[model samples]
Target: MTLTCIAVDDEPLALGLVSAFIEKTPFLKLVGRYSSAVEALQGLLTQTVDVIFLDIQMPDLTGLELARVLERSNRGAHTTRIIFTTAFDQFALDGFRVDALDYLLKPFNYEEFLRAASKARQYFELVHRPEPAPFVISPAPPQPVEAADDYLFLKAEYQLVRVAHQDILYIEGLKDYVKVYRQSDPAKPLLSLTSLKVLEEKLPPKRFMRVHRSFIVALDQIDAVTRNSVQIGATTIPVSDQYKDAFGQFISRWL
Candidate 1:
């Protein structure tokens, strides 16, 4: 799972360094970078980020102050993790007081940055990991002489769209939205304001499987299944550890 993150620092060099480091890290997707805490705070209000690489010392709104505000704004379970980056080591205690995950002493190497990032990644993975749904077998119901209607009506672009179940190649999950990709026109995807979990329940379990946290692929649309990924058309989706066991059982049937 990729973690969406933003960097906030008053110094140009510090901001650029964190931005570059985030770019280099595969799991970290840079959503936005700012040179001031005010701008970063505004961006946070608009975007759903998983982590923040913030510099503790800034004019007007220090990272500590911003963290306090964020703590108040986003209380309870879905709070964003913070990693303070500062030249002074004295602020380390203050960083922990605000529940910062990790801190980086400026002029640190890439390895050190990666270690801190890894800690944040582990924390998120533990907290936000998907639990495996209980699988059970039920007695088959009486068959209908005529096949039941196999289509879903989804609301998109202010219109109710009828989509055939078999036409879907895969579904990608954005923060609060899901993009349904169809085999008919791979170029266009129908965007709906729904969660992946909701679609997972709507789709026939026999036809689709959740291979990754962000992806649910059509079993018949899968052209290949590698040791770590599944190929549908030109796209290769990773099979995360959380769903690997279920996928393995599915593959065992035909293997």
Candidate 2:
């Protein structure tokens, strides 16, 4: 499926380059192009875009501010994904905080732009994939018991893989799937076709905690806690205001 997108940048040259990149991409269709964040925000109100190639810095409104506005406006269901295109590398963390699909550093080549665009394409494909048919049950089998509860089985791709609870660093929820980051495999996370809420119910409360609407962290794996974020290995997960108090209490026990 082709993804409808928009390009927002104050720099004429930068905007032209991004728009061109989107045009050349096989699966991306450019729906709008704006020179400022304010103008882009207005365009978004009427446009049904699937992705946005946004610049982080602008005179009137920054990309981060506009991202927050979109986040609030699209609270539930699948919201438009963002791919931040900027010169600054420091805003990388802020980009993830707003759940951007990807980030492209300025002056990047077509290869880099295509790589980021591919991620957005994969995300939309997952979101729009057809549902599986219901299974018919046979006679009930005897339930096995007396096994250790440290590990659980999760369906990733087409296989059910066993995952240890302690090995999980954090879990990030996408539209209809959750990425399970594990200590054993830090580079690639296991993608499961399950909701965060369902996993939240299955995981032990003492070992895991929901820190944000889109994030759940393994309490034992958190290396450090900041005022509004948690550090786990190389990744920094934001703690939203909704769960701040509960997470703060979790920190208090260790302090």
Candidate 3:
């Protein structure tokens, strides 16, 4: 079966790259392609796309910014799986806030693309299958994953990094990925992860909160709030329309 997909990028060369990559995959059907997020948004309004190859930085609206707007609309349409294709590695943790399918770095090889495609296929299969009876990956025999409740160990290139639930600033969901931010350095800090939803389920909700689609700042960690931004330490996170009301209520109830 052909998977209907859309490719959006501001750069002409990047657009050509996506076109070339799609040509190699027989199962992928290029339903549409756009040079700007505005054009892609128009396309999505009328047609149904199974997947979207989105670029983060654009002239007017970025890939991340557009997704936030669409989700806020909450239209009655089939949800499109987002796949973020970008060169910015630092935003990996923030991408997770939007429940992305995967994060593909720029100038990706076919093998890497295939890996992401394979994962996407497996995801759809798992989605179709009935929910499993709580899975566990401990030293012991078949047991539910208990570590999920405690804390998630984020790997930041060097070694195994452990982050407590209270340390999270917020998660940002990219096209097909997510990013995680925790309490750390200002100019340089710790971050790791490629999926937001993946980490959200692992966090303890009593302390963690999804304040924005691109952010899940720790309630107690927030130092100030502007009209459209939340200040957590030195970080200024955007609160998109999709998460405004929910995040507002979350803060209102606590304060």
Candidate 4:
């Protein structure tokens, strides 16, 4: 959980203060401190650090230029996150353009520095955490429950995806696999190796219906229904002739 970091500042006092602050923080480990970006570049080549506390303005080489070079060098692996430290407010936007973790304005106290460091720690934790393996639990004797479970887990892309049943908009069968579209994120669908027929049997009959050989629609997610199709968001899912009669009967009860 510890993050190795380095401080780069042209001013001796600023560099010393940042080095001290990094030492004070238990999670932060100071590996090096440089008076210029050029001097820091040499150190970076020999070592791998998780975070970089960079000063915006420095003689010989600017922080923005150094960040760009680091980004190119570490395209897919061992990427370093930069946190720009500067006195001027104008460089804040530029720091973000270089994908800096945080901007610490000049005269920032230890509290503000700690907040920025905490953000960097959280980001690394989320991105670097390993995907959990799927597991199965043994069934126990049924007991009275207060409410129905709202979520189910499905294995996808070698990871278990916890899908909220209420968020599902529809399920589209693709041969032996199915694509689950949900309300929370319409752009991406979860793909898994499970038959549409099996899914249909598992889902609650009151909330979902098989409208076509390859499509199952969530009753509550249907925005509009026509003679031949149902609308959910931008997708127009077809209601085949075989199920039209049952769909019509269901609609009749509602209208």
Candidate 5:
């Protein structure tokens, strides 16, 4: 199966090189090329590709930041994976943290790029492999009912911990789990086996606002607001372009 892909880099030369590499790969199909992470994010809203050849460092939004957004949003059910291409070797850990398939350091040759592309192709094949039909099909489970506005229960460390809405400072999304930061406990956060999107649906929208794809901040706990980020206590959470207008309106209310 040919994998549809896109190349994103701020530098024209790097973008062109990656695009050319995609074209030469027999198993890969190049769909789009973006100069900035912001442009890539916008393009992704309408375009669905199998993989992304992403650059880690960019002006408005870094590749790591964009990967977090895609992970949280699940790219609207497309499940597009990332293969980071950058000059910085330091971002390798950060790239993997967001589940990047591979990290290609700058000045990489077509052979290196092909190896990464081959790995991606294998992954997609495994994911798309067909399973034998089961004779005894089980019924689907019911969805969880929304909790009360005052509090919610989250399963953490094998126990259902009761968390009050008023005590929460912010929620951070990490892949499939979330770290719920509380006002009472500043240093330690409760880790729950749930997505930020799941928690967002349960929380009262007026009391909490999702400022970033990876973060949902308590509206009342915001201490300060900057051009692209919000300060909650000593921690700063970014407000990405997708949610910037809503967050700006929230800021305008108090000003």
Candidate 6:
């Protein structure tokens, strides 16, 4: 079982450091991160939040103030455990007043975090009812499937290649051949035997999107776009009419 958590801090470095810690701990999956108390408030209101790592010294709304507000709200009455994160030792009492699961000081070691995480796990197991936490699909507990894990180990001519999830930029179809643009080397795109549509199902929808019948692009790598074409380095690929709706939502957010 995984403990879905979100980290909130006014500082970007603090957010990144906490995110790195969460990544190292596989049981804790990061749902989101916020740089302000206001933004965090909005997310909690809509998203089915389980754990929150809140910093106490934010600008507009102090962490204590935010905690006070959440504690009173009817939504917060449900089983969400908050782990207050802060730099000051003086405010430990304030955190306990709000029923914080654990208090973590900044610049904490992995072992310290693990201890805090263990406490969170205990609280979660004790409180949360046996029900799927809300998401669009409410995906069944991430199970391992051999078909889903399959990735081609390609060798073009003499050079050996290890094609993994992160190595791929996008896929392009040309008749029977599909080209996988290398993420590391943008200048080169590898030709492969796999069908573009078949490989599309293997990749996560959040990371990859079908922009055209003959093309799919990595959402992370897309830098610039026009109405018809999206730029990945020097290459400009067309956005077909078939995937216009999804492409439009992606564009509206980024643009």
Candidates' TM-scores? 0.52, 0.61, 0.51, 0.56, 0.53, 0.49
Could you tell me which 10 consecutive residues in candidate 1 have the lowest summed lDDT? 141-150
Q: CA shift at 223, candidate 1, in angstroms?
A: 62
Report the Cα lDDT for candidate 2. Answer: 0.88
- lDDT comparing candidate 3 with the true structure: 0.72
Residue 163 of model 2: what lDDT?
95
Model 1 shows how many backbone clashes? 0
Per-structure clash totals for the candidates: 0, 0, 26, 0, 0, 0
Please report how far candidate 5 places residue 130 from its true position, in Å. 0.5
| Per-residue accuracy of model 3 over 1-255 as CA lDDT, tens digit each | 567788899999998888678768887888888999999999998888777888889989988888788667776645667778898977655555555677888989888876766555555554465765855467767755445555666645322356676666667777554566656643444555446666667777777767666567677788887657788777788888877776777667757
lDDT of 1 by residue, 196-224 (tens): 99989988888999988899999999988
Score residue 86 of candidate 1 by CA lDDT.
Answer: 93
Residue ranges of candidate 5 with Cα displaced over 4 Å: 133-255
Over 1-255, each residue of candidate 5 has an lDDT whose tens digit, in order, gives 999999999999999999999999989999999999999999999988899999988999999999999998954545898999999989876775677888899999999898889878877886687985654544976566544579987756333467999999999999988999998887999987789999999999999999889999999999999879999888989999999999889989988
Candidate 1 colliding pairs: none
**TM-score ranking from best candidate downward:** 2, 4, 5, 1, 3, 6
Report the number of the highest-TM-score candidate: 2
Ranking by lDDT: 5, 2, 4, 1, 6, 3
- Deviation of model 3 at 118, angstroms: 1.9
User: Which regions in candidate 2 have their CA more than 4 angstroms from the true location?
Assistant: 75-78, 138-255
How many angstroms is residue 210 displaced in model 6 relative to the true structure, after the best TM-score fit? Answer: 71
Stronger candidate by lDDT (5 vs 6): 5
Model 3, residue 68: distance off in Å is: 1.0
